[model samples]
Target: MKRILWITLCLAVMSSCSCRQEPEQVALDFLQSFFASDYKQARVYAAPEIMGILDKSQSIFDSLTPEEHQEVKDYLSAINITVEAPEKIKGDTVRLPYRVEFSRLKEPGESFITLRREGRNWKVYALE
Candidate 1:
């Protein structure tokens, strides 16, 4: 019984410690949460700098009335964003390329998210 308990405890700790996701996944999660207006969830994947930017933008989002905010969210929900595999990885940083498509867009716009390795985790913090 003691050995079984110890093994279970070790496995739980190891699994939790290894929960860090890939940069592409972090970017997708951050973008989705941001678009959904779920700032709290987005913060989990964003770096402090990105959070600063998001906070400022959120202030603008906040200025809108409740109905306006919902309208904006509805519009954004119709847009489609496709994330691709990482296009570049150097040292401890990675660039994940993605495409954004919407009715207003004549063609998909290409962009990339920049992530830096922070300890065992990847943090989404930049764009290009």
Candidate 2:
């Protein structure tokens, strides 16, 4: 019984330690939420500085009429976004590059997203 208890404790510890999600996944989730007009959910992934900015602004979707909102959603849906793996650019900072493609666009759009390590979690530091 003691041996079994010890094994169970070790497994629990391992699982708990692995619970943190990858930074790239967090960035993708943030983008998905932002584009889907779920600012509340998107804010969860933002760092405190970014969250403050988001809090001060009116909802990007809330200001639009229903038709406009639909149009925006359609435009976002029509675009294809691809996020690359994050690379450490400096201490506690990572740079993530992603590509955005649209049928009507003459060229794919590319941008770098920044992330910073906050305690055990990664947060969205900036979007550029």
Candidate 3:
């Protein structure tokens, strides 16, 4: 019984530690997956509101011809995303600014990703 109790306590602490992901990290993961056209992977980091959009995007990609899909994949693979430190906006809300650097472009494009705390985890709320 004592061993069981100790094991349970350890498991609880480990779960809690692994359950929460920082908003900035979530934003970077979402951007990298989404831009890679891996909508399935990206959806895991998205909020409920954004999940539908990712689903739709996935469906569209699935409908594309092989050549078209490869072309888009090759294009996306050449781009890189850099996520900056997250800024806390308000309670449970954070803004992550990121830069998308395309190989052919002289200047990187800037965008903002918003994340709201959902229970123990931070979720991607929106992009601006």
Candidate 4:
């Protein structure tokens, strides 16, 4: 009976951990939608908690000057984005590490992004 209980506990732990998604894959999918400028698709992956914040972000984007919009788009387009590592999943959140290579710029940089599991899907929280 004790051995059976131990086996059951081990299996339960393994199954729970198996359900985790790879953070890098989640980040890549989100970035693809972002680079495509598809906010609608992107929103499908946003955390419910940040829906209001992202909506406000859309308004802020609408307020950007034409030149600024073009500049940001142009700058981002020149970079190659790749996920470097997956951070640990904690509670409702998972943080992913990424690297950006700028083809047109002299120097490039790396950064991290976070994703939170919302319902059955993972949403990119914000990039930093």
Q: What lDDT does candidate 2 reach at residue 67?
A: 97
Q: Which ten residues in a row have the lowest lDDT in candidate 2?
A: 52-61
Tens-digit lDDT track of model 2 for 1-128: 99999999999999988978788888888877776666799898999768865665336667889999889888877767778985544677788997878898999989988889888888998888
lDDT score of model 3? Answer: 0.88
lDDT of 1 by residue, 27-115 (tens): 88888888778788888898887888788778889999999999989988877777887656678888888888888889988888888
Worst 10 residues of 4 by lDDT: 30-39
lDDT of 4 at 66: 96
- TM-scores, each model vs. reference: 0.84, 0.80, 0.87, 0.58
lDDT of 1 at 35: 76
Candidate lDDT values, in order: 0.84, 0.81, 0.88, 0.72
* Steric clash count of candidate 3: 0
Residue 83 lDDT in model 3?
Answer: 88
Best by TM-score: 3
- The positional error of residue 56 in candidate 4, measured at the CA in angstroms, is 4.2
lDDT of 3 by residue, 1-128 (tens): 99999999999999989988888889999999998999988988889978888988899999999999999999889998988874445788888889999988999999899888888788897988
Give per-residue lDDT, candidate 4, residue 56: 76
Off by over 4 Å in 4: 1-21, 63-75, 87-92
- Misplaced by over 4 Å in model 3 are 87-89
Tens-place lDDT digits, model 4, residues 36-93? 5556776766666656766776677678899987876776676677886644556877
lDDT for predicted candidate 1 compared with the true structure: 0.84
Cα deviation of 39, candidate 1, in Å: 2.0
